[model samples]
Target chain A: MTVELLDRKLLFVTGKGGVGKTTIAASLALLAAQQGRRTLVGEVDAKGNLADFFEVGPTAFKEREVSRNLWAMSMSTEDSLKEYLSLQLKIPLVARLGPLARTFDFVANAAPGVKEILTIGKFVWEVREHHYDLVVVDASATGHIIGQLAAPQSIQELVQVGLVRDQTDWMLDILGDPTRTGAVIVAAPEEMPVNETLELVTRLRDETVVDLAAVVANRVLPELFTRREEKIFERLPAAALAQAIGGPVQPLLDGAQLAVTLRRTRGVHLARLRRELPPEVPLLYVPYLFQRSHGARATHQVAEHLQEELT
Target chain B: MAAKKNPAANTRSIEQLVAAKEIVIHCGSGGVGKTTTAAAVAAMAAVHHGGKVLVLTVDPARRLANALGLEAFGNSETQVPPAAFVKAGVEPRGELWVAMLDTKQSWDDLVTRHAPDRKTRESILANPLYQNITGRFVQSHDYIAMERLHEIHAAGTYDLIVVDTPPTRNAIDFLEAPERMADFFSSRLLRWLTVPSRSRVFSLASRPFYSVADRVLGSKFLEDIAEFFLLFQSMYDGFVERATAVNRTLEDKRTTFVVVSTLEAAPVHEAEFFIAALEQRGLHLGAVVLNKVLPSSFLEKGTTASARAMVSGAESLAGAVPASVGSPELVARVLREVGESFLNFQVVAKREADTRADLSTVPEVVATVPYFDRDITDLAGLLELGEQLWR
Candidate 1:
């Protein structure tokens, strides 16, 4: 289905590692908050580098407002479990349950779906409670996202009957609804990321009830030359260029050629990604930024690009 | 070749490290070319060191298989044919073998090897929790990877084994996986969880924990978990001993870790963290291979000035060239585009230099692989990258 991504209450931003998944997530959250939506962006893994994107100090399980309407937090499974116990289970004495929780944490780690359910359950609960207009999760990379998205269902099947089993019904209701929840896969215009994006597209559809909202192709390189201009670039006389530039021009031209080749190579993969992805899933492109720094400035730059794309 | 600017900083080359170490574990955050780097280094060792070399990759793209000239290699090791090396125009001094970790297969193999009896083996194989652990647990991937490495090392087959770690949420997850696996098997929690259901429900000290767990998870599900762990408890000694052995293999003096990362902000931070992790654990950090580094050409003395000239004086400079090249307007545009591209890349290149300078925990060897215009999809290309690391 065609999706207006931000209209969805929940979005899980994920991709293969190092493809700017967190950047895309930060940008989407920033853009949503800029549009006056109360938004929460969470980093599922505890890399704790999410704050770098906003130039904010370290965030915690307690959501901190990084902007007017934007709040950021890092998911800690233990904290999530503690909250679940206190808030949902109505277990008042969290201090007394420390050993119980610690013991449960071991089971959650080794058990297949327990940790995933706790992590995704927190975000799903946020959406269900209307705590935020939108929640964007910087979810696990391509490898583990399926396990995470399908956690509630897996839990339902595994646990015959219990509080956790009953809990999955509502979480699944929110997660399974296309209007309320969708996944945004961020990919670079490279062979592996594109290949992974395509693979994940199929997996997300088959394995989980979450809808594929869109794919963000991040760091797309610019085309350096037009057909005619490329010919002109190729035919430029080496001797004249060297003399005119007052230095050897071979390395400079070679560098440009390298850029051209890199872009062209990435173009083929990008085309495959576009052609293969379901046409309804809008593909957003963000240009490769050669910016010197990569903190809040880069976040704003990405947000601007995303704003242009979303429009 | 770019002049070596920091020779004194590199006390030992990657080549020397590989020669001295029997096992080289290539690890870093994902998408930093860790798999390709491991393959390339193994290829180089097979060519130069003249003994059997094996590359154990957890998950490789199809193109990596093509790069090694193998249709596919799975749990069983497959030698990269001599013909494939010849096709890449190299005569290797030794054999290069490739294997991809099949987690499910490895888990089953571990079960078969460690299971106490035929009934226990069959029961564990049939256990639903066993299926879930093998199929979905992310830590299983990490533990199996290290376990496989230990198994292979113990086999005494290859002169050199280069393994690429699984991509984990945390960079050091696999480093701790073996110990964690052992701890999980021996932890009080497992004993408590696996305690007889009647006793668990009746015990005073555990009453509150059971009541909470029973309500939260339901008694039936807890029973299933209890039964699964009870089954697993039979193999506890085997698993713990094997995990301890794997940990020993990692800490072995003959084993060294080569952390690979691009100079991107996140990856470099992870690399730094991973290096510190290695140091803290007293694990050997043999070298750091920085992949996809921009060329130093952008940092040359006159290149920036030349690029600026091409941009600002494009029209006039186009006039200086032969008319046969193209219309002056097109030539000028081409010059501007090329010049602008150079400046753009120069910014990134400079950023890389600054990042490299700021890298505080670099080891005795720091190798940089320049950005390849194309993906490395063949043995020759792998060698091309290998040559840089070898230097």
Candidate 2:
């Protein structure tokens, strides 16, 4: 189904690791904010690359507004767990029995799905309670995305009934409802990423109930050559060009040839992807960026691009 | 002998590591092409350098499987057909086997092999309650992948076992998984949870505690935990032993870690953290494979001067184009498009080069594989990568 991403409360951006999911996620937030929405772009890992994109130092669990409408933070699982533990259930036990409480801590922390649940639960809580119109999660890559998306369900299954189960149920209500949540898979035009993106789609259909907002194809090669240029270029490999188009223009011819060839190759990959993916999946293309990594200029450029295309 | 203590140099290349190391693990954050890099290094080693190689990949999506031209891969080692190797122009003097980690099956195997007897194994594995408790063990993938690495290494069948690790949440977590596993097994809390005598504290501690737990959880929850512990308690020592062995294998000099990442800001930043993570653990460093980099030649230093001159000349020509053939507006538009793309091309190129320069401080050989014309999804494509990787 085609989803207008802005309408959804939660927008999760995920794909293969190097496919620029974080970049797209940042842009989505920027655009959402530009549209006057209070947007929170959450990063799951403590790595703090989002801060870099926004030209800020590492941020803690406390959300910081990096731009007018955009706020970003990397949630600490421990902090979330602490908040979770402080609720009505465990405060008495931890205060009374030190050793038993410590064991309880170990068991609570070491149990499978606890960390993931905490991370996701924190994000879902923001979506539920925060006044923000949009929450864009810079989720872990494809390998971890499924587990994160399904973390609530897994926890719900594990905890048949309790405060923990109730919390998971609330999180699941926000995530599993299509109108409440949507996903944008960011991918490059390359094969492995597209292959993985396709796998994510199938898993989304079968495993989760999240809506697919759009497929943001990041760093796509922009088309440059015309039919005439292409026809002329077909006969002239770099070697032939070097021999025939000698002298001052040789470097230009060479660079242009390289550019055209790369673009053509990317086009082929894009065509293949189109055939492979569902035609209905909306695709948003983000140009390859060359800006310095230390600032948010590239992100703003992408946000502007997102605004132009998304509308 | 020790990665030359220079991640900045090009001395200890990928080819050298594959030829020398008994194990090379290609690890990094997700989508950085670790599986492809590992497969390439393994194939190159087996076909060109001569060794028995087995590559263990943790790709749940099975993209690596598809890239290797397999319908699917499982826990067992599936040999790459001789014909495929030959077709990829790899004249193999040694065997190259591939497999994807089967976490569930591996978990079961760990339980069976470590259990003292068939009765305990059956009891632990079949326990309705303990099943999820253990099956979904914390950091199970990380622990299992490390165990499988040690298992294959201990077998001594393959000269090299190149592993493609699951994408890690934290670089530190990836490095510490085995230790964490050992810790989990030996933790006093685990012992308390699993041992019937030690388990009674929480259940029998106080009337209020017992009543609260029973009301919050089911009344039978405590009983289930007690029973599950009784069954798994016998296997604790065995689990600890295996975990220690796994740790030893990782610490061995014969084992090396390779960082695989794309030349992007976030991934490169993570790669830096990962390399440090390895160094902190005192692990052997092999080579870093930076994949899908823009080739240096598009506007490499040697070509930019003449290329810049030509682009200006073309724009001027666009200004003077005859109206009969095309309006100056259309010509200018085409020229502008090309100019825009070229600017983008240079931008991407600069980003990669800048990252590459930043990475030179890593003090190990760094291999830069240029963005190929197509996605690598077949054996031939992988062989092409193998060629570039070793070069």
Candidate 3:
């Protein structure tokens, strides 16, 4: 496989929950690291499955080496907030203590843009921190990734002074540039996720004005059946075969029918997605890996699959 | 007790229901306009009712920010645009505040506040295990958010606080914040484990090997426990005190839980769960806001003409149309099927409504905001949402 998109410095992978987003992210990071680029994979969601994937204990804001040339960290909003307060406010223990800290936490958690701002702020910092050559964020699914990315802009307007505002402004500039920051949407070839992917792209284009680099249609079925199999099924003796197969065959037939139905439905959604997506944006199809895509082995498989499109 | 029928019997406007409280919780599933409704209520309280209002949301998605005509909101209470309120014709009598929940920061603040000393704070923060455990505990975030809400209320900055709880995935965690706080405090396991090796328990080890084991495992264990307790101690005390006060406040009808939902089965089911959970805890179920409701009028007027026009137009334009024949009818039928499914969901919602006598009413089904055919990336979209929700 030709690795076309592999040289990119940043890869932002996101999809609906439970759609193997983490697996794909881990693989991409692994691929980058394996190719000898200093790589770091980050997750903003509360579920820190990356540590488990790397066979390490849970990680925090501090980057821990997971593999050669690859490091991992789970962004903690509280830790980031504390770091921000200490570094920005320069108020030692008091920054975290007293009414002001509580008020800050409350406001941060209660506001729509604050959490995203903090999470993305951390990413922007990592990008500029010069710790690694590439940074990959396992962003929340399509529904929220746009908002999360745009959070810095929302927050930059409120705080005019200091590093927070400066970082926000800088991050916005980086994110606004297509070459600097790339968003790759991961989706299963299903109606909801595809529709959501399309909607998300349209929104990102409209709202953030950032172009999406690619659409990764994950868990696509391989064309397993051919014309011969179709003909065989069609030519089977109707009554005798039905009787020979009996009740067990009924469920198998039902299962086959369901599979066909699902495949056809998925095909239609995929078609719609292709029709909606701008032609320039590369659409990468990753076939369904039958086994659970956990740990290094599964991730490597995904990496191999992603190698051509990524490069 | 009036002889005449109650206009509000079948349906009540959200304005009447939210008129009384300083806080209204819009709780529901994703895509149900819970965020939009929460913003509108906060806007209503600030502009119409003449009260300083704050809308707190935990939706990681900035949909709420988009709906409020704000470029973005942060962990601090940012003021809503005056233009938004004026455009909505909502007379601004008091300031409008908006914030999103950052549970981690709140949790950390709780820890730092309660730590016995600066040394203890440093030790707890430094420990890796403490960091891992605290991060994994989802309720910790909710407890901190609740604490923040109490602080906001105590500060008297805003008269009303409209909170949009995290989506239904962890609705229980948000509601059970107090209980979780109490549990964290009362649990002695961490305290027992963290006690220093110099203490009586580790002194029992006499041999050099045992002493080494004691030094390594015992100190590590104690540090872990100490770190855990140290981080949580202040939060525990504060949470208990605040929870007691807040529980009483809620029980006395000072706080209101507005259960927001859609006329859809899953959302309605989630609303029912919220109601049951609230009632079980003795908290008042203030109001139910059924959002994104397809107005019954749209269903009755079938698009027969539109369907026919599309079919004829498709035939005239192309020799062979793609996919199955009657594609327009199929699409319409699918939409109608979705509508029927929603109607069935309303049946379930109505059933739940009947079972509960405590403040159950349906607001007119707000139409689904058209996807704008464009991405909602800025404040304009949020303001557009504000208009739809308020109306």
**DockQ for each numbered candidate:** 0.71, 0.37, 0.03
Q: Candidate 1: which pairs clash?
A: none
lDDT of 2 by residue, A1-311 (tens): 54477878998899987788878888888888888999999988667788877888887888998879888888777667556555546455445433445544564543446667778888888888866899999987877777777776666666676665667767878888888798899988876777788888998887776777788888886666678645443333344323322433344444566777777777776777778778887888888665656358878899888888777
Candidate 3 lDDT tens digits, B1-391: 1222256543544555566667677676555566666776676567667767899887655556655677788778888888876666555787888998776666566667767789777776765545533443333456666677877787888778888776433356677766655654565433443355467355544533223323322334334445555555645565577777655555656687777665433355566777778777877666666554423322222233322332334233222222332344343333232223333333433443343332243222222332122233334444455455554
The CA lDDT of each predicted structure is 0.89, 0.73, 0.60
Question: What TM-score do all the candidates reach, one by one?
Answer: 0.97, 0.89, 0.49
Better of 1 and 3 by lDDT: 1
Poorest 10 consecutive residues by lDDT, candidate 1 chain B: B1-10
lDDT by residue (tens digit), candidate 2, B1-391:
3445646454667877777789898887777778788888888888877778898987666767766767788988898878877677667888889988888888888888888999888887887655554344335677788888899899988988999887667655756877776776677656655545444665664644444444444444545555676676688788778888888888898888888888877777778888887888788777788887876765555454434433555545554444444555555455444445555567668877777888877746778888775667677888788888886
lDDT (Cα, 0-100) at A201 in candidate 1: 97
Q: Which candidate is the best by TM-score?
A: 1
Writing each residue's lDDT as its tens digit, candidate 1 over B136-239 gives 76668999999999999999999999999987888899999999898888888788878887776677346566577778888788889889889889999999
Between candidates 2 and 3, which one is better according to lDDT? 2
In candidate 1 chain A, what residue range of length 10 has the lowest lDDT sum? A98-107
